[model samples]
Target chain A: MRRRTPAESPSKLSDVARLAGVSLSTVSNVLNHPTRVAASTRTRVEAAISELGFTPNRNARALVVGTTDSIGLVVFDLKNSLFVDIARGAQRRARGRGYSLQVGSSDSDVEQQAEHLRFFDAAQVSGLILAPMHDAPESVDRLRSHGRPVVIVNHDPAEANVCRVLVDNEQAGFLAVRHLIECGARRLGIVAGRRDLQPVELRVEGAHRAARESAVPVEVVEYPVDGLEPEYGDRMGSRLAALDRDERPDAVLAVTDMLAMTIISRLTAQGIRVPDDIRVMGCDHNTAAWGGAIPLSSVSLRGEALGEHAVDLLLDEIDDPAGHVHETITIGPSLHIRESTVGRPTATPPA
Target chain B: MRRRTPAESPSKLSDVARLAGVSLSTVSNVLNHPTRVAASTRTRVEAAISELGFTPNRNARALVVGTTDSIGLVVFDLKNSLFVDIARGAQRRARGRGYSLQVGSSDSDVEQQAEHLRFFDAAQVSGLILAPMHDAPESVDRLRSHGRPVVIVNHDPAEANVCRVLVDNEQAGFLAVRHLIECGARRLGIVAGRRDLQPVELRVEGAHRAARESAVPVEVVEYPVDGLEPEYGDRMGSRLAALDRDERPDAVLAVTDMLAMTIISRLTAQGIRVPDDIRVMGCDHNTAAWGGAIPLSSVSLRGEALGEHAVDLLLDEIDDPAGHVHETITIGPSLHIRESTVGRPTATPPA
Candidate 1:
């Protein structure tokens, strides 16, 4: 048998007022700002709320506050630590403001992303934070028509009239290649995943830019991986190892930390020495990359900051919908040079 | 200033029926089982549903169908690769069933876990999947009383009147130690984190059981870490490296793969040759263990399978409310012997 509440409808503010023998505004005051109500009266109102199981109806509440107390976040891949860090930052900020969060992963599928957006729209979340893969502009328009605020992450909003939180991927790429060049690496291998991805292309472009600007002549080779996974990296690692020592690139930069770690493992197993033979670098500065078999050198994309600012941007839009001016916030990337690039020994005891 | 629907109330079933010129049952039939209604009738009802923006009230619909179309999942730590794999599997299964998943991380805090649960209950998710850190029984009771079904992951239900999806932690522990013993290790050290945690205790119990079963007298030593993280592991690694060669154990197993990898890295940096000097093993078989500098030997806890089965258990409860009996599903663990134990060279080209 299904459970049912005795009340005809979900408990209401009026019902709470009636049960507390107080005016409607008194009950509203107690709920909206308990400090305004006398302590004894607030206790009575809270008891009434509990007795009636009165959940402040979000739809009705939204009409009063101009938005619901819930935020929705959609990511390209939830399994990635980069997105996990973003979600963590968003959660911290949302909790501080007494809001709940709903999360979804599109699994890199545009249709799935669209479906998640539709769900959020119907659920009536106050604001949305999306680390978009595709259809972001169209989806943003659809969501905005429902009178909800949307913020995009990772992607450069470009000319779109939307808020975006981004990291300078091109600068991160330039830093990686430039550092390798400074380390006397003239021949470089770029382990790229999915050319269609904007971040991947931008990183490659930045690497080429840095190479062209270098005083020494440099040759950059591209090694394409079919997917953003370790399996693809493993396959590429084997192929790279087969190249004669003279033919192989002296340094490598993987698109993501996962690729960097897997390729390094395979390369090490093939008797190739890291830094001594070929320095390896990765993007995203993932948590896994730090304590793995090799501490990977990476461009720290500041995932947590991106997530926090995205929520801040969305909330700003939600607060001033009519006069809201869309703004794009681009965060800079920092490089963490660890064992893979610098041949630094682990466990250096504190000074 | 707030957005409001034009209708006095969100369009009800009656509105959908009247607009389609059909009875309430016919509208319900069209929505729930379209095959029961004629194609023309179904089209008319769907059009009315779209026009009125009638989102079948989930609270009202649950009285008839016993459940909603949303599920909630909470993990103790989102940073752990173990929980990420679990979430990925749960999301995939939830999507296949046409349900949306909401995810939260408790950050190993009991109060945070309770808050997430209360939020999930208020949001009215039909079912919840939790990888709980503390207060399992109390939290389960609170949610159950609110007519929500919950499935616990990692923790054994242990005769509780609730559904649970667990991996054999005791067996996983036994396998780790037994494998080391089989590989000719006589003295062993176990890096344990928080003896109060049931899983940790259970794993330790299993390792002791394996040691007792060994024919040769084996010395088992316990090294306590304040937390189950890489920092603690690094601390423990330094201490072990400083021990006299004659006093140090020939093999070691950490409670988790995170600890194992860090310890291995630290020991390697301290000039300790793994396997040749002291073999290292870990539990939970995290993805990071695979591509780390050492390629750690670990007991694969099958986190994804546990997550997938937990969803199945929750859905079973939702589908057959009265007939559903709580079940404890225990998945077995497997050992992955890698370079940390075997120390084999990588990348031999396949013949």
Candidate 2:
């Protein structure tokens, strides 16, 4: 029984004006900005607006007076706490401005990322904050075509042309490796995330650079498995321990705290003493790393500051579309040393 | 410098119908159900809609027929993986039934929950799926007054008036303890979540019941710091190790798998050998627990099933109000013994 009673008709502005006993301009002023209208007339117009249930038509009105009180955020891997922290920061900033966020995750899939872009396009979001993976340059171009403001995160192009917020990964990696070296570690192993990822590349590059500069010939090995996490760390730790004493690396560096914790757990379980025998270090000083079984020694990638800056960049882009400048803002990679990387540096053999 | 424009001469259905070269009924059908209309006719009607930007007056329309397309989900902790999994399940199922879910987190704050309720009220969502922390039965009663549907998750008092989804916490607790006892664990510890929470209470009760039934006296220690997480587990583990050897429990059963992993990590780093010195167990076999880490023995709670059932309950309440029943569906807490709980039943107690 799908029957159509005539679609409900909204009260005309004329009706509202007539009911308010005012000129049409006065009614318009009241709807647009009541503060500009006289108090007595404003009261009448308000009464009429309440009576009519008029939430001024956004499409028609926005064209004349461009404003939509919404913000959009596109992220990679909503499951990741890093992204969640960024989203939380963005949400706080957005809410402070009396705006709400439309959040969507790409789940690390390019297709999914594009789909979210399309949805936000149709939604006509006022601003977009994206943390694109792998193919960011191509996605940036598509985002520009939508005629909406966009700010990128976790990416800083070697030759930049976009607003970005990120941590200094190369420095973070150097700090992590240098810490192990300072603690008397020489034979080193690093469990890096997908090598193709910029953070991993930068960190590894920095670690090797540090090795080249240092007198001790640091034998650095890439412990590559499927992902950057504890599970793979466990596997790597077990294999590393199986090596006869001299063959095993003196220390290991994990690209992420998650990997660091995993390696520590596995190595400890296998009767390999931490710091006393082998040192462990990592980047990303997330609370979970501190909160978990072993408080990991890590280079704190100040995610909150990055997040706050990302929001600031988005708001800047939103305020002035023709601002004519795009750049990446990098925050801290302060080192936090804990039980994992404690002992002094040891002699290392050349790789 | 905003000026009043004569509200574009009232365009009626007749004007749109004539312009689209379609009958009024055709336009009505296109608006109500585009699927029922021919593609060409639907395109024509859409063109007309764009030309006029005709918005059916919602206020007048509401007076005649009340319905909104959105569904609402109220959860206490959206940041939690357990809740996130449940949210994803709910969103997928709701979207399948042609409804979009508007999600809000209570943050375990009653005030925040009420504020979100107000937003949902304004949005006029068709149904609600609540993971409520406070007195929600009263809130549910208030929401029902608006003729909207509500379903509670993991709550009690499941009557024909409401629908709920819960995990068998008692069974989960019982199985975990039973497995430890079967493994010849002479002393046991239950590391649970927030003590005030209903789920925690039920799980602890189950553990108590199992210990009693087994005729083995078990010592239970409750740690109510923040929530059930890795950090809390680590704190608990470290504290347990610090206790007198005779007073310390042989095995620990974490309320959740994340807690279990944390406990494992903490004890290992502290030079305490798991299984040999202190066995550990946890509930909820999440991917994080299973991936790459030790194969943890856990009580698997059917989160996905609960999600699927929540949707069914919501849709039923929405489709046929009279036929809708408020009831709770309890799912499994099957025990899975892993390396953590290694001792067989009848093992001698340590002195």
RMSD values, in order shown = 14.8, 17.8
Q: Chain A TM-score for each candidate, in the given order?
A: 0.77, 0.72
Provide the TM-score for each candidate, comma-separated: 0.75, 0.59
> Per-residue lDDT for B219-333 in model 1, tens only?
9999989998679989988999999999999999898888888888888888887868899998877764544565688887777777777776776677556756667767788
In candidate 2, position B211 carries an lDDT of 83
After superposition, the stretches of candidate 1 with alpha carbons farther than 4 Å from their true spots are A1-68, A229-231, A242-246, A261-278, A286-295, A322-324, A338-351, B1-68, B265-276, B287-293, B344-351
lDDT of each: 0.77, 0.66
Q: Kindly list the per-residue Cα lDDT of model 2 for residues A183-237, writing each as its tens digit.
A: 7888888777688888878888888777777777787777776787567878877
Best by lDDT: 1
Interface Cα RMSD of candidate 2: 10.9
| Candidate 2 docking DockQ | 0.04
